[model samples]
Every structure is written in C-alpha cells, then in structure tokens.
Target: MNRSYEIMFIVRPDVEEADLDKLIEGLTGNIVSGGGEVKAAEKMGRRRLAYTVRKFNDGFYVLLHVLAEGGLITEIERRLRVQEQVIKFITVRMDEEEKRLAKVKALRDSKVKRSALPAVEAVAEAPAAAEPAAAV
Candidate 1:
C-alpha cells in the first residue's frame, strides 16, 4: 500500500545550483518511474548543520514529499546513500501523523460547531460577573 513520506537530504555546500537541480530531478524522476508520486519538492538552500556531518559543516537542504510503497522508499534511501554529493539524509513516514492530525481537527470542528451557540450565550451573559463589583 502507498503511504506518505517526507525525505530530506543535505548535499555538499560547494555544489552548483544547476547540479543540485539535476540531482533533484533525477530523484523525482526515479520516483515517478518506480510508480510513486512526487507530491512536492523544496530546496531549502544551504545552511549550517547543528553538527558536522561527513566532515562538512553546512550543506544544501532539500525536502521531498512523496507517496510510495515501503520498497520504493528503501530504494530511494539506497540511492541517496551512494550519492557522493549528499552528506546527510532522513526519511519519515507521515501517514499516521496526517491521520492523527485529521482526526484531531475533525473532533475540534465538531466540538466548536456543537457548542458555538452556548459559548456565544455565555459570553453575552458574562457582563454581570465581568463587572468590577461596582468598584467594591
């Protein structure tokens, strides 16, 4: 079954913008050819790393949101591992997180819609208590 994923990778800082674009295209191409869908691709630009990785202090950051099966993700990870320009990378599965967020939002919406009238009524009647006790 397909699932949501976010793959972020850091490439060497010295790489050219053109090369970076090519690399991103290649990865996204792989996903499409592998029967996965590329939902989004973002280049967050170069920035300092919290700590050194592969002896590099900063790198170009890229984020990808995709939907694919587990096997395809594994393959993509393998490709990233072998790409010399990439210094660090991580893959996170977001399906569960998305589902949880949706559930919370639905519950919140239902509660708000259900009690909206009551909340308005309470607010309208709060002036008596909100008064400063007639200046004590």
Candidate 2:
C-alpha cells in the first residue's frame, strides 16, 4: 500500500547550486524509477541550522512529498545516507497526521453550537424571580 511521506534533507553548505539541482533531479528520478510518485519537490534554499551538523553551521534544505510503499522509502533513505552531499535527513509519515487532523475537523463540525443568549436570560431572570420570592 502507498503512504504519504515527507522527506527533508540538509545538504553540505558549500555545494554549488548546479550540483544541488543535479543531485535533486537524480534523487527524484530514483523515486520515480522505484515506482513511487513524487507529489512535490521543493528546494527550500540555504538556511542556518539550529546546531552544527557534520561540523557545518548551515546547508541547503530540500523537502520532498512522496507517495510510496515502505520498502521504497527505506531504499530512498539508504540512498540518502550513502550520498556524499547530504548532511542530515529525516522522513516522516504524513498519513497519520492527516487522519488525526481530519478527525478533529469532523468532531469540531459535529459539535453543538451553544448560544449565550439563553444563559444570559436565565441569569437576568434569577434576580427578578428572587425579589418576588422574598416579597411573598
């Protein structure tokens, strides 16, 4: 079965733009060749990292949205680990998160919309009702 995944990787900061493009193309090609669908491939550009990785302070960020089987994903990760330019990488399954969000949305939609008017009227009537009771 196919599942959605987000793959984010950080490449070495000193790598040239052209080389980065080629690397991304090659990886995407691998995905397609492996029978996985690339939903989105985004070069998020270079940015500073929170902490130093492989003794580098920053690197190019790449995010890929993919739909594929688990075996294909593991193979992709293995490829990334072997690649020289990739400094750090992580893959997350998005299907569970998507399902959770959808469930929350449906629950929110099904909830009863409570109005404040009735409660306000009850509070307002309480004082008048108490005054009459005291008089009686």
Candidate 3:
C-alpha cells in the first residue's frame, strides 16, 4: 500500500549549488520512476549541525514529502546511502500523524459549530423576549 512519508537529509556543505540541484532532481526522478509521487520538496538551505558529522560542522538540509509504497522507500534509502555527498538522512512515515491531525481538526470544527448553535438560539430568543417586555 502507498503511504505518506517525510524525508530529511543533510548534504555535505561544500557541494556546489548545481550539484545539489542535480542530486535533488535525480532523487525525485527515482521516486517518480518507482511509481511514487512527490508532494513537496523543500530546500532548507545550509544550517549548522548540532553535532559535527563526518568532520563537517554544517550541512545543506532538504525535506521531502512523498507518497509511495514501502519498497520504494527502501530503494530511495539505498540511493541516499550510496551517495558520497549525503552526510545524514532519515525517513518517517506520516500516515499516523496525518490521521491524528485530521481527527483533531474535525473535533475542533465540531466544537466550533456546537458553540455557535447556542449563541444563535440565544440571539433568536432575545428578540421575542424583548417584544413582551416592550409591550408591558
């Protein structure tokens, strides 16, 4: 089954911009060729790493949101592992997170709708109540 995923990877800081673009294009191409869809690809730019990786202090960060089958992820990870410029990488399945957020949103919307109903009823009743008071 296809599932949502978030991938965050750090590339070596010294890599040229052109090379970085090529790398990203290649990775995205791989996903597409593998029958996966890339929902979003974001270049977070160079950032200081909390701890040095492979003797480097800073790295280029990239984030990708994708929907793909489980096997496709393994293929993508394998490619990342083989790339010399990739300093670090991680992938997380976002299906559960998406579901949780959707549930919370629905609950919030229902609460808002419920709260509005009482206020509307009160407003409707107020005009009728004031009519009798004004007549008296």
Candidate 4:
C-alpha cells in the first residue's frame, strides 16, 4: 500500500551548492523510479548541528514529502545509507499524523464558522434593540 512519508536528511556542509542540487535530484529520481510520488522537497540550507557528526559541526538539511509503497521506502533508505555525502537521514510515516491533523483542522473550521454566525446575528439584533430603547 502507498503511504505518506517525510524524509529528512543532513548532508555534509562542505558540499558545493551545485553538487547539493545534483544529490537531491538523484535521491528524488530514485523515489520516482521506485514508483513513489514526491509531494514536496525543501532545502533548509546549512545549519549548525546539535552535535558533531562525522567530525562536522554543521550540515545542509533537506526535507522531502512523499507517497510510496513500503518497499520503496526500504530501497530509498538503503540508497541513503550508501551515499557518502549524507551524514544522517530519517524517514517518518505520516498517515496517522495527517489523519489527526485533518480532524483537528476540520473541528477548528467548524467552530470558527459557528462562532461567526452568532456574532453577526448579535450585531444585527443590537441595532434593532437600540432603536426601541431610543423610542422609549
């Protein structure tokens, strides 16, 4: 079954920008060739690492959102493991998170709509009530 996933990876900071772009393209190419569809790809740029990794104090961060079969994820991870430029990488399945977020958003939207209607009705009634008080 196809599932939603988020992949975050840190590349060695010394890599050139052009090389970084090529690396990202190659990784995404692997996903596409494996029958996965990439939803979003973000390059978060160079950032300081929480701790040293492979003696590097900083790294380039990239995040990718994808939908793919379980097997494809394994393949992608395997490729990352063998890549020399990738200092660290992680993948998270987002199906449950997505469902929960959707539920929360829907509930919030409904509450907002309900709250808005009463405010407008109350404002409309206020002017009418003031007119009667003035006549009295």
Give RMSD to native, each candidate: 6.1, 8.8, 8.1, 7.6
CA lDDT scores, all candidates in order:
0.90, 0.89, 0.91, 0.90
Error of 1 at 36 (Å): 0.3
What's the best-to-worst order under lDDT? 3, 1, 4, 2
lDDT: worst 10-residue window of model 3: 127-136
Which residue runs of candidate 1 sit more than 4 Å off their true CA positions?
119-136
For model 4, the stretches where C-alpha displacement exceeds 4 angstroms are 122-136
> Per-residue lDDT of 1-136 in model 3, one digit per residue for the tens?
8999999999999999999999999999999999999999999999999998999999999999999999999999999999999999999999999999999888766655655565566887555555543453
Residue-wise C-alpha lDDT for candidate 1, range 1-136, written one tens digit per residue: 9999999999999999999999999999999999999999999988999999989999999999999999999999999999999989999999999999999888766655645555466876445543433333
**Native-referenced Cα lDDT, model 4:** 0.90
TM-score of each prediction: 0.88, 0.79, 0.88, 0.84
In candidate 2, which residue ranges exceed 4 Å CA deviation? 112-136
lDDT of 1: 0.90
* lDDT tens digits by residue: candidate 4, 28-133: 9999998999999999999999999999999999999999999999999999999999999999999999999999889766755655565566877555545543
Model 3 vs truth, CA RMSD: 8.1
Give one clash count per candidate, in the order shown. 0, 0, 0, 0
Q: What is the Å distance of residue 87 in model 4 from its true position? A: 0.6
Model 3 ranges with Cα > 4 A deviation: 123-136
C-alpha lDDT of candidate 2 relative to the true structure: 0.89
The candidate maximizing lDDT is 3
- After TM-score superposition, the amount by which residue 11's alpha carbon in candidate 2 deviates from its true location, in angstroms, is 0.6
